[model samples]
Target: MNYVILAGGSGTRLWPISRNSKPKQLSQLVGDLSMIEETYHRLGKNQSVFISTNSQFAPLIKKLLPDIPAENYIIEPDKRDTGPAMAFVAAWMSLKHPNNPMILLPSDHHIRDKRTFMEVIEAAENLINSRQVLINIGIQPTFPNTSLGYLEVGEEISKEAGVHVYEFKRQKEKPDYKTAKKFLDQGNFFWNVGSFAWTPNKFIEAYKKFAPVIGDHLNELIHDLESGGDGSEAFSRMEKVSIDYAVIEKIDPRQVLTIRGDFGWADLGSWDQLFDQLADKADAEGNLVKANWHGVDTRNTLIYGPADKIITTLGVSDLVIVDSDDALLVTPMSRAKDVKKIVELLSYKKLQQHL
Candidate 1:
């Protein structure tokens, strides 16, 4: 199987620390190593791995993962959303390795149970070889998370290599709180973590059936690549929509299969989520500090900054304090998810330097 780690996100929710120049995947948010580095190590060595990112990040990613061959990096010319980005990847891979199955993995996710994670991935690969279906690795929802997408799973179809495969009924992208709670109570919904497995040809076919314009653009890209030309023109002409909106949600339920992954998966998309993931590493006062710190009454707070500067806090609780070189973000834990709005506000104010 060919593994492609998606690392093109701007990570706006983690802004100030996660900027456009250096996104969260390239930042040391969780541990000493960057998130992408952790993800690469988790996948293990001696496998056909690739990094799917934009041209701006190609050099940085290459410097970080020098072991990965130069030819393996799939660099998109422009910043299109996942729809065009993934279609471009499939087209490129189909031209190079058409027979191999491809798996799309996120570079910023935190998975504690690596053994179970690999087991599920192996099962997905086995199922793909045995059947003709687009596989989506769905996580068992631990709470009513309205921020994440939900997959409505149907009856069990089969069990391949100790992993239970189910029929994918439909997908609900970020439903309301009431709907999310109802979904949790129904016990048939799984969090869509954007992890998908399919052959390059199979994915191209799906685009052709559901999104003909994108399919047409993909063909043009494939042709351009064969003719010794970059696919920038074809990619720029494609729609800038997400994969869920363009194809995944519209695919025939019969042709889609889902695997339940209980691998302690958590998308560290926000500061609060990051805090939750590293909760076990917090200090006695419920403070998770990464900087030179001296706290008097800081409880249940996350202090992230450079080690050169000392961050002192007093009588602060349930807050997130991130001290970047150019910016400092101080927000309550409840409002950490709204940090993306700050990025938007900065853009609106034309403060590109800060962004």
Candidate 2:
């Protein structure tokens, strides 16, 4: 099997820390290593891996993974979203290895249970080989998250595949509290983790069925890819769309299957999400600190950074105070979602340096 790492997100939602040039995947958000590096390590042995990213990230990735082949990096011409980028990847792979199966993964997600994650991938690979169906790895939702998209299983493909994935229902965009509870009660919904697996030929066929323009461009795009063109033509010619809208969501019910992901996963999209994952539960004062720190009246707050900087808090509750040498962020937990608004406001005021 081959691996395609989709690494072209701007990570606008995680601004200040994640900038346009340095997205969250490149940032050291969760652990000591960058998310991309961790993603590379998590994959099983003996798999050809391809990284799809923009030009800005190319050199950085090369520096990080010097052992990886230079040709494995698939640089997009522009931000055309996942569908087109994935089409290009599939088409390219088809030209070289049409029979080889490919696993598509986002570069920025945090996967905690790697062994279980690999098991899910193995299961998907087996299903693809035996049943010739495209697989969508869907994570079991741990909370009522409004930020993520959900997948509804249509029917069971196999009773003993350990998981039964049916047809993918239309996406529910950030459901209200009542609707979210209803989904949970239904017990058939799974969080769309965006991980996918298919043979190169299967991928191209799916694209041709759902997105003919991208499928038609395969030959010419592959030529440009081989010749190492500037990527101007391909980017301009391809339509900007997501995989869900262009293919999976649009495909006939019989062509798809959903595989439940038991691997602990998080998109790492927001600080609040990170808080939920990393906050020390043992802190009695509700003051979560990564390094050495002293606190006063700082309840239900998170502080992350160096031990030298004494992030002293007074009369602050339900807040997130992060102190980096280049930037300092102080916001109530409820208002953390508005950080993008802060980014926009900062941009409007011509505070480009801070951005």
Estimate the TM-score of every prediction.
Answer: 0.97, 0.91
lDDT of 2 by residue, 208-261 (tens): 777876766766777786685755686568788888777887777566678887
Top candidate when judged by lDDT against the true structure: 1
Quote model 2's TM-score: 0.91
lDDT value, candidate 2, whole model: 0.76
Q: Residues 107-192, candidate 1: write the lDDT tens digits.
A: 99988988888888898888788787889988888788998899999998877777888999999999998999999999999999
How does model 1 fare in lDDT?
A: 0.89
* Cα lDDT listed for each candidate: 0.89, 0.76
Task: Please give the lDDT score at residue 102 for candidate 2.
Answer: 84
Task: Give the residue spans of candidate 1 off by over 4 A.
Answer: none
